[model samples]
Target chain A: MTFWGDYRGHGHPHESSWTMLGPLVVLAVLSIVGGFVFNVPEILSGMFPIKEATENGGPGEMVLTGISVAFGLAGIALSWLMYVVNKDIPEKITSSLGGVYTLVYNKYFVDEAYDAAIVRPLVQGSESVLWKTVDAGLIDGTVNGMGTQSQGVGSLLRLLQSGNIRSYATWVVIGAVVVIVVMGVTR
Target chain B: MNLLEILIALPAAGFLVTLFIPRKQEHLTRSFTLIVSLLAFVLSLGLVTGFETGKPGQQFVDNVVWIANPDIHWHVGIDGLSLWLIILSTFLTPIAILVSWRYIHKQVREFFAFLLLLEFGLIGVFAAWDLFLFYVFWEVVLVPMYFLIGIWGHDRRIYAAVKFFLYTMAGSVLMLVAIIYLYTLAGTFDYATILDLFRSGRIGLSHTEETLLFLAFFVAFAIKVPLFPLHTWLPDAHVEAPTAGSLMLASVMLKMGTYGLLRFCIPLFPVAARENASWINVLAIIGIIYGALVAMVQPNMKKLVAYSSVSHLGFVVLGIFSFTQMGLDGAVYQMLNHGISTGALFVLVGMMYERRHSLAIKDFGGVATAAPWLATIFLITTLASIGLPMLNNFVGEFLILQGVAQAKFAWTAFAAIGVILSACYMLWMYQRVFFGTQGKEPGETVKHHMPDFNVREWLCVVPLVVMMVWMGIVTQTFLPAVSATDASILDQAGTASALARPPVPPTGGITHGGSLHAR
Candidate 1:
């Protein structure tokens, strides 16, 4: 009653936790009565259809089965209690599990460790010594020097292709005069 | 037509068809290329259906004399080693075509033609059963890749392309010399004949010759594998290349080296392979750890992925040298898994690039909200790349580990670290891209009004997602085909020696040393 809200069921005699608790209590009582009165074999057997042996051949066999049944019943009771306790929990309690979930989802910073241990050192070392000195200094430097050399050669080549028609004609005339001079000298 | 002949000839036909594509209607030319590529793919698909998994030696084999003069024949076959690789190359090209559909607007005819030509070369490499033929296919790959990068790549494209070409060519030249020498010794270019001769000890090379030839082949394969110290050119090529080019290099091209090692070096020269196996194992382990460490720190996502190839391919190398059945199968499986998973990854990364025009990991966050599909695809591909159990990568990695474990405990332990490192980098990259706020700064055209993947992107991704799941679960179909071959490989490695030992008798039981191999 103290925990009851302003809903219409508040004042009703039947509407209480005791009322809900009554059925479970009655069921337990009925089960005990039914076990002795009807000698229900199903009740005697937990799940399997086989009947328990009644021979008092050994205490050990009885003790083990009894322990097993006790454990099973205890597990059921504990689990039910857990269900009741956890059923009304709020989102905050549930989402607290996300912390560990996120860590797994992020796959635990092994990449960072590898980077620190191996990649950074190798990349840095190579960039400084090998790449700069050999790859760039020797390889690219050699290639670039070739390019610069090609440009030097290219400029000299361009001097030959200058758009001077008169120079071309003079060169042709000079070649002819040289040919005539050579022919006359030979004669 | 026989499957092997069809496998070889279909692509050659495609190569021919691509030539006849009219220059005027460039779109028509593109359509022709697509049709030819689709035809080749269909022919390869015929392989999956017809492939007999339990029987592991060569199947659908067609060998015949092509040259009468010098004793060369058009020999080709598909074993477990070559089967999936052929399928993977065939599968990716059409998708590559579709991806390039919009992006490669300029030189429409040439792009598709080169791609088709490239497909032809790759298929030839996978199916060639002759040493001379294999080397021919090997060198054939260079031209298309060079053009693909040089013509279409972004920023210093020519430089990257030339470097790639030069490096591969230099390696191949030495390999060529080795191939000729092998031909001289064996007096046949036939692969099976040479392998049989090698196994029977009929073909013998002097120790110096063996070392030289091994070095020749090793240098060639290593550059392609781009094992640790020689791996410098990879990042540049990957970063500068087009999406399809990057995908091709990461998924397929890297495997060429490991495949060469298994096909040509180890089986052809088992003595030398066994002699130098430990040194190879050491280098492979270094590549594994070193690649992972470097990948972990990469600012550029493409560079990270490129470095990861070095690591992932390192596993393939380790698996190869483990000299166990599990190891060889794992190496082959890893090769295929790398193709599927990494191919999917590059595709997704390409979609991201199309939107943002940047590959810097820090450039965006919480993209999951805008493009839920993109985020989901990226996450799944990332998981596969990380080799999560039930995924395709996991099976291969697990097998490789078991193989290495049986051989050397310390090697297996070090390789396991690479596994942990893989999970680290992949998951970290995933979180940074998908979680937190989904926005970018102003004035960056790509990011400012960046819309998520449209219909085209979804079409590209859905198949990859389906494949990732399907290949993961039904790995039996893939595994069974290779198991017999793997067993034979283990037989050669003497792995059966240890396997034959009886299980340790339980406590209080008599040890059965008399009949150890009985069980």
Candidate 2:
């Protein structure tokens, strides 16, 4: 990975200052010497109990430690050979990994997953379902529906509003006949 | 003249005066409206200073016969519950005036006139002790708010205004029918007289009649609170309303609904309130969670704040229905807290709108960098809104949750999620607006139009922020009066204020102890 940078035969030395490197120097010393002098995990454990490492039940701790160190060194060697010796191999390996490489490179698609499950659905639902369907469609629809329904009834009744006296006489006669009939039936 | 009479009259007089102010003299119009509202606030403070705590009753009362046949009276007063609410109305009126000072350029005279008229309606709503008078004040609030949103608002203002008007009118009409029915039975619209008649059993309501009446008043109030399914109008109203209009609508107008629930609905029909608590609580919880979930995805800022109101007010509704003194007190306190926090949120939103002429979240980036002072005030308000500990909302929400836990622990657990979701939406909206990835290279709007807080903006915000802190930390200044009033409300209803002292199991047993007035 270091070899992957633009490393010319001769490089220009960058400007350095105590304000910049002074902290770096202290951090470097702390990273090395602070580990033994002050154990962070040990200190933190008193306040917050650290979770015990899982028992894989495959091998003992000693064997697992040795295996992890060996694999770490092998990873360095492999990276060196791929990047320094032949830069093309890294790309080839990445291509071979394909979807897995993409997934891991995007940090296991955590942000994508969150967007898909929570964020996008909420936005889509709010816009399309809650706002559009429930609010604009159902609630407001019912309210407007009442108005339109009344108007429809009025339009039907409007036909009976003919100014002609003949139609009015007929409605009056029909009203009298229904009243008499209902009165007689009740009697 | 009685102080309450003067408090009500000052705004009415100011409204007429502002109406006569030449529309060309915009500065005079603004300054006069501000002065009137400031005077109203000052007079309202007199109520607080003279307010005798540890008494749960109406004070500074004024009565006069306004109508003969129906026995309607111009009755008005303040109580422990309505004291701060009245003050909240008076306090926010000037803020609303300041909010609209520069923004409302076209209808300067009429706008200030309408703003003063709105203050009058709001103060009247909190003060009116007679049912007819209350109804009048309630309907009066709608006219100015409708005009505020309609004339001064953004696109679709007409639609939002009409919808807001119709929704409130629909619910209030039912309430009117109920009020008339009560008057027919009791022979007067005076609240105290009717209470005396009902308590003495001279005026009786059968179970069915009581339930129906309760539903009528509750629906009216619920619509105002805009609980859940009925709340579709609020987002539209808040989003379409001008800055000052949104401030008043959120801060005081919405409290009218919760206030009605506490003042009229529960006291007049305690049995029905108790019987219906199960479903009302259900609706409130649904409102809490649903509002938060819906707000989480709002692309627009005003709409987001509007939905958050739905979530916050849900706690108030829940508290009201819980049938415990703690619950009632919490509900009342929460009302004041919501007024301060949400009112501040709307003002802040309006301030931002003034800069960019946009309410869309995506239109903003690096606001904190551009306007650090604005961002700082906004952060304080946001924290206050999300019920951050030692803020106004925290006290209200905590008391509400504690009260609910005593009545029904399950509800507290459910309602607590809303508290969490509140933080999620508010902070997320805060982040996207103020501290976006565009901070490195600010957007065009952020670089050019957005500026730090002006004197007027600071003046508009700082007092609300101060109140938020004051109400949060030294709750004793407010809560004792609220407790006194709520205890009286429960007592008058023949209810044990401290019902279910042992946190009863949710096995149909909680209401047994809570409802001494239960049929």
Candidate 3:
């Protein structure tokens, strides 16, 4: 609809946004003619490499090109025949094959197929496996675990700063008794 | 007084002067601090210009009897190993000051004073040859950094400061004990003399003694390096530290650990170093992969960069442990590279924080649109951080990998994974933070408040950016000096390879030594 049909929106068109449109048009032109203008394999050299006549698609290439161009022209003519010449034909086709037409109209569930096949898995896996599980859950978890363990030990040791005279005296007595007992046993 | 002496003293004097500058006279304190740091940087450049690269051993030596009872001397100098590091310290200090010009508000004088004080300690770490003086300067560095993080830092500043202090202290006290024990054994705290004594067989370490002493020093430096398991304090400290503190901690201070490894550990306890290399390299590899993975998941910018340091420094440790000339040279080169690249990252993160008042990655999007120049500089820094070719890190990492490949091809393989992971986290962070749709959550904040590098910021960052390019392209200008020191260190370490090596071929002294290291 965008390329072959009219752009019939109700908004007034100001000067086209050349900043965005310019490169896109340039790329569109390039796609149509750039291959003929430049040799891709020769430019890329090792990556693509120029081929001999057999590798370069000799007669087989011509047959494939002819087939592809014929199908393309046929599709364009059919669209123009149904829409421009006899508009009732599209309705008749849709009525004849209702469910299949709906399926075809919805683009054969391709977007859903793409989401299931490629997009969802990547997004979900990157989040859960890469970021959350490996990075945060394991590595950072270990780091924080070490921090907490150290803090636990520190908390246990902080009791020494209790400032209780009797507790200190008792510890000192214990130390002295232990020292004396060790000395006597060694002797 | 020697130029090295002046270089060390200049910061100490600036620190003292900054301390006396009254808090009310804020501009005076700021400008004076800037002037002092800049002057010191200028003085350091003299050392660079005058540095005779092919000359071996310490240059610009100074010695004074600091204590009579302890027999401690204030001996200081720089070899190729320390020269660039000291220059990095001086170079980063003024920029740290410049970046903090507006960031620090409450205790302006005290903050700048501590920064200079931190400079004083860092230089001393790099410069001091005597063990006791090294320890003194070592302790000196901790105090100001403690206050800097504790005072000016984010919410958990106190917790971070204490943890940073305790972790370092835990390593330092054991080191002190070892230093004292060594003194009792050798009757002096002079490093060169002790090395000479050890070489001449006048004094010796039985195997157990060397290992223990090596551990004592190694653990302390390791804690600072925050190598692997001991690195927990680093993330907390970095996350909480103010911009200047983070910049210093990431850049110059971490080098102290790698520098210590080269300067003291390998040379002083060659047997112990060799014995420990397998396990240490394992830990380094673990740190490399682990840090990059953790960095990947971090929501906070500073935390991501902090973990990246762990990964980057792991490469350095691997290089050092590889026990090859390529390894040591690469290790030292990586030290300077990390100081500049990571330092610049921290500074850039700080700039973003200043605008957004948040470190959360989610808080920023399309920052490139708002601040194109800032984004450009950051992209360059990011590329540098990931060891892109023609950047400073590439040369260092390549050398390290080559060296490690020579030692153990397996270790090289593991370490190489880190290089790829570094690119993953850094470029990911850049894309999310810089290239996305502008003004998502903090859209209004960024569009209005986020300006590109102002004059002061440009002044601060351009030097660092230029340095990244300068060091990357002109490796020869720096490597000759570094290679010299690394060679001497390896020779002194008496590695198995060195011990089993052929004797000097007629031509003696540095030319033969220089030829040995030239590869």
Candidate 4:
């Protein structure tokens, strides 16, 4: 089938379009009704003519309720107008204040700034200084250095183990003389 | 045989029997090892049944003389402190062996044999009553663990193994020298005798002598507990070692260090321990925060887990240094909690590695879609590791924070940040691996290879998960057993030294109180 034919024949535009708006409208209406329903307890109590009813009733409460409802309805109407009736208004306003729009669009560049100021340096420092220089170079170097130093000492000591009778005799004679001289001096 | 002797000897006998098992009979070897570990675990439970709560001294005593010249003895026993740790050792061995069944295919006989040998050494380390015996067992642990890592470990295993050996040995040699010096002064290698001698003021130590001896043992245990700067060897050893090795290393082996601190360091040199506690607490806090921060950035899963262990164990050290009954109890309990949670995490990671053969975080995603059961268990373990309430780690971490808060409020507040950081890293890793839409790159043909836990793996992990919940819920059940011992240790330390901190009130019978002695 051709694309246009498929779109016209298969797509139920009226049903699908209503489905998108259905939940939002229902929620908005329910919330508005619910706001009044929440005052039922107070209204019912007022109708009972209790002794404290007149004491509790005042113009302040009425005025506060009127103001709240006025603001709430105004907000809802504005949202509907901006979102559905005149969708281009938000884009126009944002474009008019281009600097603030860009600021909000880029999330104030906080993440980029952090990456530049903190994360990059941290990662680079850890890799170069901590891992490379400290862990691998300094710490491991010192550890391995101990091993090599011991090995060097062992090899140097091994030189004295050379199997030579004349060398052993000479070393024994020198050791005996040194021992005798040390003992005599101490005594 | 006496219960403690059998508890120690069963594993030794298992090691001998494993030696005779033909290398080709892998199943037989595994079964034998499991059976022996199971028996050891069952007998270790006898310590619980036979143990009298609130009792002050060591039970299941098995003392015998071994050498005459330096007055050494084959003395071994269990107290409230050592009993749970002994049970922890025996408990993890069977699980360790079971987890290694598939992972360790080559040198099957030697692997199981060394594992059993390591178990024997670990039990001895916990149970030894004599200084010389403790030292012997301590060194014995090093040899087999070294071979376990070097033989069956991942690439770079040799370097890891050697570093472990050299680092541990360097700390231990100083300890050996100190032990010899103490022997000369007290004329015996018996722990009780030397402790009594020092306690009774018969063997007097000048200030320098006290500090030196304390440091000698402190360095040894700290390296093992791996507090802060001394902790560099742990990540390397943990990452390079096989799964079972990592489990034991994180679970029971690291406890040896903290246990040593409780068992020997504080009691032997209270003045120095109390004097140095401030700096030690500083190190502990540093380790707690440093470890978690480092873990947050780890690309390798095993390394991340390894760093978490450093963080968790730091709390244990912090608790011990806090020197309150709650702190020490939490420290001991945390030792066990870490074993369950972190060990289980390692096992899960190992299972994943077996399937995918890669431990890099980027290598896997949306694993839950493929293996929901495995993912669920991973999430549970991750939560437990992060100290979620009603999980094992939470009770321990809470108690530790409570304890440290009393001792050093600032340290506790800072250490609490580590808890948040732990959650950050563990959950972030979990999310990256399990919750995403794709576990691998698109068109990756090997996606079907990964599978959930089978019956054997379930058997391995079920006990851990159960214990994690059990310990978290009924902390009261475990706390009382160790409370009396913790109190006595602190009491002795407090009485021996002119401690600057206020005396910790006795913790006996005060369940859930906010005091340092809270049961």
Number of the top TM-score candidate: 4
Writing each residue's lDDT as its tens digit, candidate 2 over B390-463 gives 89999999988888888888999999999988998999999999987433454443676898888998899999
Who wins the lDDT comparison? 2
User: Tens-digit lDDT track for model 4 on B393-486?
Assistant: 9999999998878776788899998999899789989988886644456633335768888999999999999998999898877888788888
Top candidate on DockQ is 2
Chain B superposition TM-score per model? 0.90, 0.95, 0.94, 0.95
Clashing pairs in 4: B365-B439
Candidate 3 residue spans exceeding 4 A from truth: A1-187, B437-446, B495-519
List model 1 lDDT by residue over B64-99, tens digit each: 876755557678888777788888888888778777
The order of the candidates by TM-score, greatest first, is 4, 2, 3, 1
Model 3 chain A worst lDDT run, 10 consecutive residues: A48-57
Query: Which candidate, 2 or 3, has the higher DockQ?
Result: 2
RMSD of candidate 4 to the truth, in angstroms, is 6.5
- Summarize candidate 4's per-residue lDDT along A1-187 as a digit string, tens digits: 2322225466555544677789888899988787556765565776686746435546877888799989999998887777667778888989899999999999999999999997678656655665567655786578778889998999999999899999999999999999999999999
Candidates 3 and 4 compared by DockQ, better number: 4
DockQ score of each predicted structure, in the order shown: 0.06, 0.37, 0.14, 0.16
Candidate 1 residue lDDT tens string, A89-158: 4345447777775666567767887889987786676446544575446754664575588789999989
Candidate 2 RMSD to the correct structure: 6.0
Each candidate: RMSD: 12.1, 6.0, 6.6, 6.5
